[model samples]
Target: MQKNALKNIIYSIVLLLLVFLVYLYRKDQPITSDNPDSDVFKMVVSGQTMGTSYRIVYLDPSGRDFKQQIDSLLEVFNQSLSTYIPDSEISRFNKGDSLVYESKFFFPILAKSKEVYTNTDGAFDPTVGPLVNVWGFGPGGASLEDSVSIPDLLRQVGLEKVEFDSVQVRKNTPGIYLDFSAIAKGYGVDVVGRFLESKEIEHFLVEIGGELMAKGSNENGELWRVGISKPDEEGAANELFGIIALNAKGLATSGNYRNFYIVDGKKYSHTISPFTGYPVVHGLLGATVVADDCMTADAYATAMMVMGTEKSIALQKEVEGLEIFLIFSDENGMIKSYVSEGLKPYLSYAEQNKPSLDQ
Candidate 1:
């Protein structure tokens, strides 16, 4: 009887110890990894890319050095996308290679380009390269001449002239060159953003040239803030039109004021109309677009420039996931502005219309 009692007591003791261990395990569960407050340290990385500069800020408590890896990755990225490089996939394709080929980066950019191309009604044609060259903005472009043939170039500038699938890319017509410059910088920003993410860095801001992609929060544990430049030609440097609180968003700006020429009392912008076969001449001074991805934002920004003020505004109203701000001149050349309803919360101030160009 005593032996039986001792066995029962031992079993009970073992059961209690097991219960205590499980309780201890439950108490030791970790906090959520998605918490934004834990990543306070930031590592900044910058380099030249796509004929422009790139900047990346990411969180890393390990102090890991990714500069070499980043440089190498960007170098290969340039090789795949840069038209300036004669041997690049894009360059070779432009030179008349018919194969789509496999690439981690080129295909995604091309797919996004096609998506924007379709949605924008050819307003964002990458095949406008031939026209871009004629306007003195692209490789082998000449100085603006009084007389230049445009109708001939229009024949080659349609996005429909090119076709691509997962395994193949073919141009329906000869001389249909593709130029992704409008969206490539934004894609570069995304590339860097993905690189940071792959390294398990959760909080990051990536900017290449003027395009940007932001994820999570900053060191302040607040949303990442990005500034849009005022369209003021006479204002001080770094003057902001307004600040945008960016969280898991991509931003891009397309402006005629930045890359245009005044010749013989006529202004010629780099943005060309595929339908008109000429540089866009419209009331739009600039367009800022926010999208789910930087590539879409960049392409839409350029497309909106081609669509002009009214069309773009209409587009903003109908699009489900786009936010935009437009700075344009009215019929009297008076400066005005339009802001999407979704973008109002992001603006730092009231963002009323510009006083006047004279101001």
Candidate 2:
């Protein structure tokens, strides 16, 4: 398959997104706070490992009612989207017909994913489960390296090779499966965002894993600022490669940081290419995308990773309203970066102050 064709396939399978809440620490000296809807202070119920934290800060005259509502919202979101629960819609679908059939819940996201797949020319595949498992990244423990042969693996993988009817989805070849891990978190974020909005949360921030969506503003009226990870080093973040005013927008980042392996003397990325049946070896270390929906941003970031730096730039030009930030290594081994033009609208003051490598 051509590079573009391969990317489109992986793009479809790479839709799963994961979120963790991490930790929340309030100011040592209670920062001046304001009251809006209800005076409900921020509280984190779980750890980041729980994946994605949904917080609601409201002006609640009666703290009891607000707390109850927040808890109810969180429960609803978990019930609907949690893969950890075997009874959840996603979990059931993933374990049942999703193996060789399509369920009702799968169609909604599948339909939405079609546009992203077509636009990226198959760079983003949501049906890359089989490959993910063979590479030892699936739900099961890592597969023996020798058990998977790359050439043989390629024959069984391909987005086009998978057939999906309205009622069922099946692979052309046996043993191929689907995994939406890449886009799941994004979907989860959207779910939580909607739930909060239903509670009349006009302004708030929601983050799952690294996927996030921010809107409205703190009572003080400052836009929510987010920091993007610097892929050069683990646990490093740049002040602000971009910022969304929470004028109501979302951000999702896909990178080769958390999951990867070293083979021989080279490092292999976890974002595997369905076309080659091999982990992406490109110098493009990470890509962050901003869009109205966190799911789209999440999947698109992975697609861009396979597109690499050059193709990603060209593709960005063709797609409007899509912003991308790529961290890549040049020939000399130095890490370099690029940002799509659309991203300029969200550039934070600090990002603007930083030297523009593109120029």
RMSD of 2: 6.9
Q: Give me the overall lDDT of model 2.
A: 0.60
Per-residue accuracy of model 1 over 1-359 as CA lDDT, tens digit each:
23333333333222111101000111112222356565344567767777666667766766566778888988998888888899888888998848567467877888898888888888998999888877666755444455767887788878777788777689899988888889998888788788889989888777777788889876556788776666654443255566677869998888766555545566567788887978888888878899988888999999999999999989888777899988788899876777788887776632453333212
Model 2 agreement with the true structure over 1-359: per-residue lDDT tens digits: 13323333343233212222222244212223464444444433322322334443322222223445555655655554455556765555555544432333455556656667788887787666667766655555346366667777667655676556566554466655455667766766676677667766665666766777777665455666566544543342433433334447777878775455544555556688866777887777778788888888878887888778888888878876677777678888876778776676666434543565542
Among all candidates shown, the one with the greatest TM-score: 1
Name the lDDT value of residue 64 in candidate 1. Answer: 69
Model 2: runs farther than 4 Å from truth? 1-105, 163-172, 234-246, 349-353
- The positional error of residue 204 in candidate 2, measured at the CA in angstroms, is 1.0
The model with the greatest lDDT is: 1
lDDT of 1: 0.73
